[model samples]
Target: MPTQNQSLLDALNACVAACEHCATACLQEDDVKMMVGCIRLDRDCADICALTARFVARDSAHAQHLLKECAEICKACGDECEKHGAHMQHCQECAVACRRCEEACRAGLAA
Candidate 1:
């Protein structure tokens, strides 16, 4: 992969990890029902990030399109996570990761 893709790839991977972690942690929370939305978005965000990373890794023709979709999902996931961040460390971390990934995706599109 080109050096230009490295940062985005790293961000994507980190977001995937963070989302997965967040989802798992949310499931174990005292009120799992309250975390349903966060859990759902975390899973969705992780899947999209993973897919986008694969597309970018291979320099796929559809990578740019995926990047745009990835950014949108990341933003949504980050926003959802942020809602619970005040009391959830996992959500806070996930939100930060999602934000970084969203910014990276936007930068990739700009490039």
Candidate 2:
């Protein structure tokens, strides 16, 4: 793949790691009950990101459709993470990664 596509793939991978880490860390927090929504979104976001990476890497016909969906999930996940960012380092990092991935996905779709 080209460097441009490679960068998007890298962003997807980073976001996946961030989401997984955030979900795990949230589970360890004292108020696990309050983190339920965040946990669900984190896992969903990670899965979508991984799928998006695969679609893009293979230049699949569904890539554009998946990118759009991925961007939406990333936005939602970032919003959720930002809500807990003040109290959790993992959330803060995940929020940043989600935003980056969101932007990258949109750019890829536009291109």
Count of clashes, each model: 0, 0
Error of 1 at 111 (Å): 0.6
Worst 10 residues of 2 by lDDT: 1-10
All candidates: TM-score: 0.98, 0.99
- lDDT (Cα) of model 2: 0.97
Candidate 1 local Cα displacement, residue 61, angstroms:
0.5
Best candidate, lDDT-wise? 1
Report lDDT (Cα) of residue 22, candidate 2. Answer: 98
lDDT of each: 0.98, 0.97
